[model samples]
Target: MTRTAPAPTRRPASTRGGPVRQGPGHRRAAWAAWGFLVPITAYLLAFYAYPMYRNLELSLRHYTVRSFVQGDAPFTGFANYLKVLTDATFVPALWHTVVFTVVSLAFQFTLGLGLALFFARHFPLSATLRALFLVPWLLPLIVSASTWAWMLNSDSGVINAALGAIGAGPVNWLTSPDWSLWSVTIANIWIGVPFNLVVLYSGLQAISPAVYEAAALDGATGWQRFRHVTLPLLRPVSAITLLLGLVYTLKVFDIIWIMTKGGPSGSSTTLSTWSYRLGFGNLVPAFGPGAAVGNILIAIALAFGLLYIRLQRRQDPS
Candidate 1:
């Protein structure tokens, strides 16, 4: 009656010799992952990293077309960078670049957000309309630039014709030094709107219907709801969008080149066009200084990229 079953004794780790139970399949999978990564790592090192290193080397050297032909370029340390900084076109081109980027981003974000909000509400043919709006983004940049150039031409252009009809007396859309930078800025904004629309619309779609419903129930107006609910949720997307816009807009050469050739007295020149002007625009190319300008652009991009990463870490912290 009193014979109760005794509990089983635990095995000691020393006697058990634990964790020796992994199979060959697990080892194969681990090896396969590294094997898969090897090609990607090698490709990145060969293509991106190596070229960047070579560019840095070129920037440090007193290289020219003759030196390239001779396969010898003597190192001049930071002289090329100094030359780029002191060059006549550098300051003005840099100023135009800043103004162009800022104005373009301001208009693009404002208009794109408006379009995104408009499309967020359910309506007839909304999806089809949204898809149609992506035409600007899908077209080649060179094509868009060429098209805008023709449209903005002062003579025999639709814009000038329309202005003349309205008694505005044919304002110079492209050739005037006062308006050349803004002309390209307008075209850039048009080209960039679709990208912002699609991205911001996706972000808006991710927001919960219940959240908006609750906000509406709490006596929030349309603007109030957008400010309190939508904006807060969309901050991350907007941050990345603007940062990428900065990087992309900063390097916009084709639009400025095709539209104005940085012309009408260097009014629309950006750093990218300026770099090209340095390296290949004329008979004697300044390869070293051009490379230096490109490297400076890369540095600015990398700084913003690092800032993006820091923001991501703050958002995650995991």
Candidate 2:
């Protein structure tokens, strides 16, 4: 034991024969990271930031398209906002928007959730069927709206033809103010369902199979498993999709415009259509009011977006 050799002392890094060398790899990696970031930075600055600032500036100025073309406009403080807030047209339009958003969301979410759950179950041609269902979403908005408009036309349209064949009498699809919003909403629901389905299906796929197995082993049935596990797990994705759908549906202009142009008596006018009317409809263009409506929509959407970000943050604690 006494003769046992003492273990050789380990040399400190600084006491090594030569100083430790650092490769240029870290600096190169940093430069590579910035190089990759530059294009996105430039794109955001040029497209998103500048345009948003310009829109804000325009909202503050009393400028029409004519005035903009002539370059003879001045800032008008909060007069635009005041006019928008007080306008008789604006409030009803806002009400229509609210109703459309709520109604469409209700239908889309219910139908979408149902479709999502149905599609998540394994079946033949599931991928193909899912892709086919997305056709409405993939189609150009103008084209899809036009197609629906044609289908809903009072005379010789397919829907009216079908009604005639079925002895139900031809129903006014777009002409009536009462029916116009619902018709557009039907098209919107069709377009939006695929989006919700896709997102929810992906979220369902992300859930671990082990959990479902355990639930099944515990005698859980399909509905019970879905209620207890699927709904709760899909909450985050559902929240995001619902908020996005609300934001988009609130600003829907093309569907309404293409089908009815704010309708028989402006009954279907949403805030977006109202803004367009104010901007460029009649003898006197109300650019200020239009911009104000747009700004209001932006504010609402931003508020929702902030809420979404906060929820995502809470979910991701790390």
Candidate 3:
């Protein structure tokens, strides 16, 4: 029998030392990825990066209304920042910001955790009650602030009325310097609780039921199970929640502005309101100082964010 010549073997594309050709699908996927990236890139440039750049530039310049409009601002280096540091409002605003952030975060987290644990039992109407609790969060911030303003009115407010019914004297919620900071903090806590509840509740759900069962079988009480099992597992979620709440509280301006306009005499002024007051609340706005204050706020937030990331990396190493 005649032996047929062996059929020529085709080498694989990668083995042949030629450029490996990509399929149409690969090209399409690459194009789609680029398409997805382009809009977000443009948006960040337009909205975030550009604004930050402008704000930084503003902080470094002596820009009057004429110069601002004409784009002829004189470069002043750190003069604006120096002015802000030396300003009378700086210390008080910083202190108020700290108190507001810490107090609001404390109360909100505690109440939210309590509610989350309560609802995790999944009792009848728990979902309904949770939804109802979200009303403060669901209402527009302006509306909420306004309502608080009315309710806290010195003479004719509902809160004062309630206190009167209980035989307590009317306390100025929004008016008094001593109470103004607390008032805004309380309102902020009320608004923020639902967010915490939702997040913590979801975190609780992610804890396997078997973990709790195991703890129970080990003769752990309810408190012990929560202390050892629940709290440790919820650490990641709680950290993130607190961080977000801190950032949000640090920048809270609307509620304070609406209710107190940062004062009976600058008592409730946080950095955010102070920045706004410098930038726009006055007849002759201190644009440079305002921008400097904003930059300071940004730096604070960035520092905390970096710290959170560092702590997370230490915990997870991976």
Off by over 4 Å in 1: 1-22, 25-31, 316-318
- Kindly list the per-residue Cα lDDT of model 3 for residues 1-318, writing each as its tens digit: 011111111213334344334776877777787898999999999999999999999999998988999999999999999999999999999999999999999999999999999999888888999889889988888999999989989999999999999999999888899999999988899889998898888889878999999999999999999899999998877887787677667788889999899998999999999999999999998899999999999999878867666655564443
Identify the runs in model 3 with alpha carbons over 4 angstroms from their true place.
Answer: 1-32, 309-318
Candidate-wise lDDT, in order: 0.83, 0.80, 0.87
Q: Which pairs of residues collide in model 2?
A: none
Runs off by more than 4 Å, candidate 2: 1-39, 64-66, 164-169, 282-284, 316-318
- Best by lDDT, which number? 3
Error of 2 at 295 (Å): 0.2
lDDT of 2 by residue, 101-153 (tens): 99999988888889888888789999899889888878888988999999988
Please state the error at residue 300 of candidate 2 in Å.
0.6
Q: For residues 1-318, what per-residue lDDT tens digits would candidate 1 score against the true structure?
A: 011111111113235434433786877777787898999999999998998888898899998788878868998999999988988888988899889989998888888889999999989999999999999878887899889888888898888888889888876878898889989999999988987888788878878899999999999999999999999998877886777777778888888888898988888888888888777887998888888999887787678867766765565443
211 Cα displacement, candidate 3 (Å): 1.4
Error of 2 at 252 (Å): 2.0
